[model samples]
Structures are given as structure tokens and as C-alpha cells.
Target: MRAKLLIGRHARLPARLLLLAILLGSGPAGASSQPPRRFEDPLCHVVEWRTPPERIVSLSPSLTEILFAIGCDTTQVVGATRFCNFPPEARDVPRVGGIVDPSLEAVLLRKPDLVLVTRGNPLEFIESLVRLGIPVYGVETRGRLARILATIAEVGAVTGRETHARRLIERLQATLQDVRQRTATLAPERRPRVFFGELEGAHWTAGPGSYVHGLIEAAGGENIGSVAPSAWSPLSLETIIERDPEVYWGTFGEEGEAAARERVLSTLRNAAAWSQTSLGRRPRLFLAHADVLQRPGPRVIELLPELARYLHPELWSRDGQ
Candidate 1:
């Protein structure tokens, strides 16, 4: 049977063994069959079986969102992390555990035919699942807008919905490319120097090798502190004063814009030299939802374009050019 065609059906072990034996008997001696796609990681491999997997479990919230986006049957998603709370429908799925530490007992009890997990899942947990003869599929995608789309396609291909996945990636790439073109119109001199702070207290900023650094550059702004080797690093007021960024971007989970602004300003103003920088005098502040921005998912296509408009109003047209 063509394995690709049977994407999401569940097959029992005994039946699969019987089918394998029959295929071996029918073939000429010493003949070899085509190998199933091997993902290299021991935890996730494509199993050639009598049937495909019907029940699925997702360990990461980001992956869960991607799976649902590819049109997976919600009822078939029997288990998910507690944080996998998007699409409203996910809330109804049984919570297996947190991302890093999942409840193996809960997962085993669900009797999932296929288990989906991302790169950072615990090795021990995956080993245990493997010992039980469970089929697990592991996916690792870099934190970029395109990778998110590729992940959609990858998941779709495995679940026999590659067509749907490809279409989704095409739409997403088009939107991002359009935004990139609009951003490119800005003259280098006109591009403002911007700083993206993850939190107020920590003074953490996204820098080199980070996906957001790419986002900031694509949006036609210079990331003031991205020269650092790490993607995220702590920034002191002295460093802020030295760079003198034109815009200060941050994510906050609080009520009232005035209160939030005051809190942020107070922290910066405490450092006398830093307060004198270009940002403190006339700052263009950008705020985003923490979960949406922090998690590397499909939302960045929607997130970055709006931020570009805010940072470089003159470059973009009245209809968000």
C-alpha cells in the first residue's frame, strides 16, 4: 500500500506485522523495499504499518496551533499541553501536562496512535514512549516566518494534507513578501534605530541570530543592540545611552496604557544618562501581545507588518503600503 495515502488512520501492531510478512513472502528473495522517510531523531520516525494513525497528541502549544491550522480533526487530537489554548477548540482537548514535563501516564492512557512533539521535549519522556512501541513524530524548525510555514507543510505532508499545507504557506509567504517590499522603500537615513525590549525590569533585548532581529530589519529599522552574540541579552542604562536608540519596543501584560508607560519610563528615567538619549526625549513605543510575539508561530506574518507601519509611517502609504 502507498503509505502517503493512508496519512491519518490507525493500524494495530499485529495487523501491521501480518502485512509485512505477506509482503516479504510475495517479493523475490533478497529484494529490498523502499525505505520510509527517516527523521533521524530516534523519538520520531515514520512507521510503515497496516494502517495510519488516527489519534494524535501534541506536546507543544505552537505545534498544536500548526496542526489545527492544517485541518486536523479536532476530535482526533486527544491530548495536548496545558498551554495549548488557542482556536477555542483546543481547550476541550485533554491536558496531558506542561510542555517540558508532560504526564506520561495521561498520554499512555489516551492510547494515541501518533505523538507530535517539538525539539525541546524531554529525552527521557520520549524514550519511555518509544519503549511502549508508540509512534512519535518530532519536528524542529528554526524561529523564522518561513520556517513556520514550512512546518505547516511538513505536518500536512505527514497527515496526508500536503495540498492544504502548501496553499497555506503560499498565502503566508505572499503576505510577508508584500510587507518586505513596502519596508524596502524606506531610505537608509530615514530608517529609525529601534530597540526591542522583552520585559521592562530585565531590560532584555532581541539581537543577533534571533528571528525578531530579522523581523526588525525586515520592518526597515536598525536594532541598536543586536550586535551582541546572543539573541537575547540584558541591557544596562549606560549601554542604552551609548546606543541612543530612536524607538523603544516592549511587550507588557498589564492594564491602562498610561500606567504601563509610566512604569517603563520610570525605570529608564532612573538612569540619568540613559534618560538623556534620543529614545527618552521622543520615543515611539510599540507593544505586542506576549504569547503571540514570544512564541515562534504563524502570527509573526500578521505582527511585523503592523509594527513596520508604526515605526516608519512616512515609508508606508495611507493603506499600509
Candidate 2:
């Protein structure tokens, strides 16, 4: 039942090093106090949005969604990357380009007062913008749940929506606590053995260091892919068959679970490949929205109950737990 955490893996900055230094102080019994007026980013640069920004740009879809969630609108968020298509309003923003290769010229044209980034944003891009006198702030939101919560608090301060951010964080905390309380009471052996990975086009999966891993554990399931070497990696079909997970689940881009169902069923039924194993006899599919499962943002909290319902339906069936 023990899994090793591979922190560094294939990232420019290791997940541990990418941790944000937000000022969302901790209170008694795992609660958060009021967010401070200022905080420090991963770059060790201090950030304080003394005046609410009139124009903002988001480098990632997750960041863009967070901006909108914290009371920011099209007027305030003037530009975002092409991949930011959530909340409908985001699609209306001017395209600054993709996350990895954004157009510097396009970013400059938007005349944003602030730019928000996630752990995946390039350090060089941030520095280039800073050199041009634009304030750039980032959040560490890859695999860590605590870091994601911290990001919500920090973004609220940046957008001057501290109350909104705190409320969201509190709701997220309450849900997490409820799930933890439920899972804690279950004996370890009783939890389901689960696998959460892409089975449509590829065999990619989340390892022990990923939020998916945390989610699987939180939902009372043991991640069969925990043996994978890194936070995100590919697993061979042979290995998956050997492990023979009791459940299979994943997401396909922004299309969500329903979009992924046919593809999954097709693959599992392909020439009776999956049926040859124990999984085919007792198939349990739990598809989720990629935006919630794969993307690291405030909305990932929404997956908590959805995943638990599939993993442990008995609790919900009896008392709606």
C-alpha cells in the first residue's frame, strides 16, 4: 500500500521548489485565517496588488478560470491564452497564444496591468514581461492540494477579491474535510484498487506526486499506477493488466466524462484485450472532466464527490455521505 513520491521528474522546476509563498495563514484545527495584503511568488519576488487591476492576462486556462471565479470579468481580464476556453467568457478574450509558446508581441498588445501564471509557465517568459515593466504573478499548482488552495487565496488578493477567494477556499476545505472523515473510517484493505489514466489514445497516468493520486487516495481507492516512476508518465498495457485495477477512469481534454466514455469502452472492448483480464469481468468506469481531473485550478475540488460516488456508492446510497 506504500508508494514512493518522485518529486523532480521531468519539470524545469521540481514540484517542491515550485511551492508558492502565499500569506494564507493557517488557523487552529486546519483552518485558514484572512489572507494578508501581500505575498511572495515562486520567483521569490514580492507581490501585492495594492490597487485592483483594471486589465489582466492569464497564461493558462486554469489561471483564466480562477480569474473569472474571483469576480473578474471580460472588462478586467482583457487577454488570455488560446487554450483558455472555460466559462464561455474566456473564449471572448483576445488570444495571447498557447501556454508553452505564447506570442510576446500579442501579450504586449493587450496592455495588461497584470499577468497570471501557473507552475507550467516559463520562467523566461515571466522575466521577459517583467523587463517590460508588467507585473507578473504565478501559482504553484501542479500536484499539491495545499498549494492549489494557497493559489486561490493569492489570486483573490491579486484580483482584489479576498472575500470571494476566502469563501471558495472555505467551501473547498469543508468538502475535503468531509471526504477525509469518510475515507479515514474505512479500513485500508476495504478501499478499492483503482486506476486513473488515459485509455483512449495513450496509457498516461498520474503517480504518487500528482493530485490525481491524492484524489484517488481521498476517494478511498488505492492507485494501481502508484508504481509509476514520476508525477505524470506512461504505463504499458501489460503492467496494467498485471495490476488489474478494480476501476478505470480518466478525462479527455475539455470535453469531460461523457466525451470520454465511448473512447474508453472501445479501447476496453478492443478485440477482447481488456476482457482477457479480471477487469473486463467486473468493469467499473468513472470518467471525469479533464478540466477538473487533469487541470490544476480551483475547480479541481469539484471532483471530490464525483470520484467518491463511483468508488464508494454504498456510503451515498445509505445516508448521502
The best candidate in terms of TM-score: 2
Q: Cα lDDT for residue 174, model 1? A: 81
Which candidate leads the pack in lDDT? Answer: 2
Model 1 lDDT per residue over 175-223, tens place: 7797789878778887888888742466787877777887888888988
Using alpha carbons, what is the TM-score of model 2? Answer: 0.81
Q: For candidate 2, lDDT tens digit of each residue in 1-321?
A: 011112222223655343322212342322434343444566754454446778999998888888888778899999898888888989999999898988889999999887887766778988898788887787776766776787888888877888999988898999888888877888877888887886634578888888888888888888988998998899886788788777887676656566677667777777365876655676788877666665677678778878887788887788854
How many residue pairs clash (N, CA or C atoms closer than 3 angstroms) in each of the candidate models, in the order given?
Answer: 2, 0
Candidate 2: residue 182 Cα off by (Å):
1.9
Span of ten consecutive residues with least summed lDDT in model 2? 1-10
Error of 1 at 88 (Å): 1.9
Off by over 4 Å in 2: 1-38, 200-202, 253-259, 271-273
Any residue pairs clashing in model 1, and if so which? 9-52, 9-53
